[model samples]
Target: MSDLVYEILQLAGILAFAISGALVGVRRRLDLLGVVVVGAFTGVGGGIVRDMLLGVHPPVSFVHWPNLAVAIGGSLVVFFVHPGITRIRHFEVVFDAFGLGLFSANGAATALEAGQTPLTAILVGTITAIGGGVIRDVLVNTVPGVLTRELYAVSALFGAGIAVGIEGLGGDAWLASIVGGAAAIVLRLTSVARGWHLPKPRFTDERAATQE
Candidate 1:
């Protein structure tokens, strides 16, 4: 992919991730600084971890201040502007699904570009998709969605799988990323809209009482 295209994807993914982070903070009624912290952390935590695992010093976001600027700015925009941005009756899931698609695909591509194996790429993709949200949930005192939702990690895995397959077939990075992202978004949105959940373990009364 062209340097310009790579940079654009990275920025778009970061912006969307940070926006969701800020929204989470907003929902929790956090102060402005708290919002920024949560947003920045959620936006870049996975990428930073990925780079560290790859032995890249300073990581991409730290090396380039624009990444930090974009994330922080995005969060601040949400903090101050989202309130006045005209409330959509259904904005929550809409933005959440969009962010899911953007970040998960970018994460998978980044992992593959760093020369991770296919399985590792998929794992990284799942981490990148949920890492931020996990942090956000912990900070906000909620359960991480992926822990309870069947389709969350599944979507990321599916995207990463598609990305690896496409690249293995000699497809362009941009095209692969797009297809992967679109697939993730569609599947995730469908799961949410349909209220699809993973099966939970059932305990017998005797086992439950014994455990208790």
Candidate 2:
């Protein structure tokens, strides 16, 4: 994960998250401008938050033309040519998974570059991965998937931790990002495919008891 590679991954993540937001916008029947706005926020909102937390006055995404361009391009592509409405949810999840992994690792790399501690880097990574999605969902008036979706935040946390661990073990940020992002993506997709998730408390059925 050289600088070039990390940049590429960041672009990919931007595109993926933009696509996620665009899909949701389309499903929600928003207009073109609305869809684009949603997509842009989804692509860069997390990075903006991360920068703010790190005390970077001017967020990188705000000044980066390429980031805005990629986000808009992804939105246009999805708006113009995408799956049927019924398939939007599936595609949204796919793209969101990709974004989640790359952004998580990217966040860790950025934090490390800023000389943050391992714990802070990892936490920032997880926040960067999920913050955009959370915003996207809120804008669309839906529950954030990270709260209820199968193994969402856990995957991000694991990915960030892996990246930090790699860096701590004498690996460069690039290698850590690549490995950690891949780990997150694999775990997320696998959890979706296999219905793996954290355990939830089950309550006995009050209706059954009343009936008995």
Candidate 3:
């Protein structure tokens, strides 16, 4: 992927993540600083972790001013300017889904660019997608959505796989990213509406049966 396009995707993900986190903070009734802090962390947390796992020294997010600037700027915008942002139903899930799509697709592309195998690309992409949301939920003292939300992480996994597959087949990176992101978003929202869940374990199923 061209650096320009990659940068754009990262920025979009950061903004979405920041908005989501800020919304969560508002829901929790946190102070302005707290909201900004949570938003900043959510915006950059995934990318920082992804860089470390990929063995990128110093983590690009740490040294790059734009990453921090954009993150903080996004947080500020969400916290101060958009009090009604969370009025949208499932606001957190919606913005987080957007972040997940962009970040996951870009993560896979970055992994491929770093000369990693397809499997590594997929894993990195999935992690990049969910890592920030995990941090956000933790900070808010809530269960991470990926653990309980069906098709959440699955969306990232499928999207990442698709992105890698497209790149492997010599497709344009932008097209691959768009398709991958759209797939993840659609699957995630559909799962939400349909209440589709991954199958429970046999023991859980047996316990439920006994209860019944």
**Alpha-carbon TM-score of each model against the true structure:** 0.88, 0.92, 0.90
Which tens-of-lDDT digit does each residue in 83-181 have in candidate 3?
556464487778888999988888887888889999999999899999999999999999998898868899999889899999999987777777787
lDDT of 1 by residue, 1-212 (tens): 66787788777777777877788788778999999998887777666766676678988888888888888998898889867755432454556566667667767776788788877877777777777667767777889877886588888777777876787788877777778888888988899889887777676775685573
Q: Whose lDDT is greatest here? A: 2
Show model 3 residue runs off by greater than 4 Å.
Answer: 86-89, 201-212
Q: Quick one: RMSD of model 2?
A: 3.2
lDDT of each: 0.76, 0.89, 0.86
For TM-score, candidate 1 versus 2, the one ahead is 2
Per-candidate count of clashing residue pairs (backbone under 3 Å): 0, 0, 0
Per-residue CA lDDT of model 2 for 49-113, tens digit only, reads 88998999898888889988999999988888865456678888899999999989888977987
**Candidates by TM-score, descending order:** 2, 3, 1
Full ranking by lDDT = 2, 3, 1
**Full-model lDDT, candidate 2:** 0.89
lDDT value, residue 39 of candidate 3: 89
Worst 10 residues of 3 by lDDT: 80-89
Worst-scoring 10-residue span by lDDT in model 1: 85-94
